[model samples]
Target: MSQRRPVPRLAALDGLRLVAALMVVCYHYLALSRSWGHNPVTVFPTLHRFAEFGWLGVEVFFLVSGFVICMSVWGRGLGDFAVSRISRLFPAYWVAVPLTALVVKKWPEVTSIRGWDDVIVNLTMLQAGNNTRNVDDVYWTLFVELKFYVLMAIVVLCGVTYRNLLIFCGVWTVAAALAPSLGFPALAAFAMPQYAPFFIAGIAFYLMRRFGSNALLWGIVLFQLLLAQRYIDYRMASNLGHVAAEHLPSWPVRLIIIAGFAMVGAIALGVFDRVQWRWLCTAGAITYPLYLIHMFIGMTLIHHFRDRLPAPVLVVSVVALMMATAWLIHRYVERPAGQWIRASMKRGIEDVRLNTPARRKARWRPSLPAAPEERPLHSAGVH
Candidate 1:
């Protein structure tokens, strides 16, 4: 039997994650300031314009996630995949929920928590489903991520193959494209067809890299590009309006998106296979916690210090503090807690297996005397 090689960590992907997380931080910092009636744009007009496009970082994250997830479960069983995902997600998320709630409660900005019910719902990470508001708006992405995981789990359970993935991508794209027109907007929202292309693009890149590129993979990549363009156009029209969207130099934004995708492809194709940096991985490791905890805390700090500190100083200080806090949480809290939880779960599963009736029967089954034929057909046929 051939043993499968372990997948190497993609340092470029980690680097990309660091960039994406920072972009989100910038976006939220600037956007939240404006929403809270503080005009950072007036103070730092050029920086604000650049920050306006930082929201696209989430899409970059989605693309990276699809690739990482496919790589993560490549050779694992469904149970292993589930355990891996749960361990990776819940520990950081659970910690962040209460921390965010505490910050919002004390600060009481646009994201004030009503009571314990809200906190409880936030802890569940199902605030959207439960019709409760998030303690922080950033929690909404967690829901999207969970949905992606659930869908990916289903795909994994069904068996992840190139053909299977290709079919899924195709069907999902069609569904996403026609959802609103078909009056099944919920399908679009839940399945995230609008974003499916990016995920599909990631999957396609993975397939191309792992199995060697082919026409089908190339086709999927092209399709994703088309879908992404359409989505961008629609977003501009619907979300930002033509006038506003037009005002924001389109080429730079398009170039950024294209460059991001290009970089992902290059990394997937081994262009950066040798670029391994531990510091980049460390930076990447804190992204989830940083993303989850940064917004409310940073905003509260900004609100408190807007008058006392210069805009640039406040932004820098908040970003630095949040990054430090995230590093601490990732190091001291998330890693240790996740390890303990996984260990405990493993022990519980082992205990259950050992105590189960089938296992018990197998364990204590009597060893009867061997029959003549089974007694070992010795060379002399002694039996």
Candidate 2:
């Protein structure tokens, strides 16, 4: 058997994760303040303008997820990929769900509760599909991420090859682009066609890096760029409207999108491969836990201190506290719990194999029948 090539830990990508997580944190800190009937932006107009663009962090995240997920499972089997994803996502998520619910329950000012059934659905991470409200609004993205995983797993199971990926990306992009117009609104919504371009961009980067850049890879990248721009235009027009879209300073938003795309391109082209910073790995490790836990906890803190402290100070303090909480969860809860679950799963699989009839048959062997036949033949000759 040929040895599988090991996937490199892209330190630059790890750093990007930290930046993305913080952007989301900042965005939520500002947006959630408004929900609590306090407009931090009114006090600090400049900061609010900057934070408004922070929602773009999610787009960056989708791009990173696309690239990193493909890289992580490069030579891995479907089963291995599934295990890795489950271990990474569920450990932090399971802990966060209850913690978020508890915070919301205790401090209803940050958000409201629809009851324990909603909490139960949140645990499944399919609350949207089940018509249950999320404890925190940030959870909608998790549903998108889960859907992406399912699609990627399908691609992996089919086989990960240049030609295969090309077809998959092309077909998916077409489906996403046309789903809304073709009476399949659910398809477009569930598959998140608007975000598909970013994900495809990530996949294109992976193909270029691993398989070596070619015309096909470049074509995919170009196509992704066009699709991404289209998606952005649509989003801005729909969400902000033509008047606000034109009036609002969109330079920051444009810069973020361009920078995010450029960063992925640079990494794919090997520009950042040699930049090894171990701290980035730590930053990446805590991002998931941070994202999961930050919204409710940070908002609650802000609600408590909004009147007592300056808006900027309150925001900064909440961010710092959230970061610390993320670190603690990553080190204590996520790491240990993931390790235990994976180990237990491995042992359970082994036990099942040992107990299987097929495996038992393979282990068993018949005694040499020839020995008895030879003895009988010798006795007959003597007689």
Candidate 3:
């Protein structure tokens, strides 16, 4: 049996995450013209062409999440896993939710808040499940991420292993592929048919990375790569709203998806394991906060300034502003708050464990008690 290997920190994935976030940023800021009331295609004739495809970044993010989440929970208990996720997710998110609400309240340009009720639900990050609105459209991805996390948590409970992961990836992939035909809403919801391949591929890549690539792992990656293309239209229709397939060539989108898998596959194969740069850490840290806060806040800024500044200049300024804000939130808010949340949750878990009924009985029961065992009505010899 192959044991789990101590995998080196792949700093390059951190860099890749920032790259993915920036892609989504560009997609939101430049590809769509409705937000700023300017034709982005004309304003960003060259860039808009590329930005149109930037939404693929979300797919990249899922792939990365698959790899990272599986890697993160490998040896950790469910309690530690929960703590890490809560601390890592909520610190920046708590700030971003209301901050985004405030922006929508003030601007109401690209999107708007329904009320404080919506804001409250968004904070829990279960807005999608509740059928409540997301403060920013980009937040839709967070719900997808949350679902993936829940599924991975189950894997952690089952114990992460090379064999177990193989079984998980196989079962999940089949369920996702069959979800629509099964005509089950809950199944589709949990299966996440459109996004499952990316996560599955990611897990497979991690298996390759940890256990070394073989025919089976490579086959899983290839199968997912093929299966992933099946959802391109659905993703485009849903995520891009009115943006039709005819507007963007299908070939490039297919190529980009392939490229995404290839990039992560290269990482799994240790092609770029030596490419660790200290700066990649900073880039990774800001990615989530940046993804959270960039959309509505950015569009609001562009709404006011699009007429006042040159198009390229305004776009650059908005991206810069978002990056700066993301950095500040990461440095000032996430680090300290994450530590605090981790400590608090740990204490809370300890309290729960100590106060359980079993523990309570053990703590209070007398040591002297030894009840006599009852004899059967018919003794063995008599019977």
lDDT of 2: 0.77
Residue-level lDDT for 116 in candidate 1: 84
Off by over 4 Å in 1: 1-8, 233-246, 347-383
- Can you tell me which runs of candidate 2 are displaced by over 4 Å? 1-8, 31-36, 237-246, 249-251, 348-383
TM-score of each: 0.86, 0.85, 0.90
Task: For candidate 1, write residues 202-265 as lDDT tens digits.
Answer: 8888776677678878888888877787667655554345776877666766777787789888
Better of 1 and 3 by TM-score: 3
The root-mean-square deviation over C-alpha atoms between each candidate and the true structure, in angstroms, is: 9.7, 12.1, 10.7
For all candidates, what are the clash counts? 0, 0, 0
lDDT per model vs. reference = 0.77, 0.77, 0.85
Best model per TM-score: 3
Q: Order the numbered candidates by TM-score, best leading.
A: 3, 1, 2
Q: Which residue ranges in model 3 land beyond 4 Å of their true spot?
A: 1-7, 241-243, 356-383
| Tens-digit per-residue lDDT, 1-383, candidate 3 | 76745545688889889999999999988988765686788788898889988999999999998888877777677898999889999999999999988887887877777889988988898998879988888888888888888898888898766777889999999999999999999999999989999999999987777667899999998999989989888777765664566465678889988888999999888898778688988899899999999988998889878889987888899999999999999999999999999999999998987888663447566666222221111110100
Q: What lDDT score is found at residue 186 in candidate 1?
A: 71
How are the candidates ranked when ordered by lDDT, highest leading? 3, 2, 1
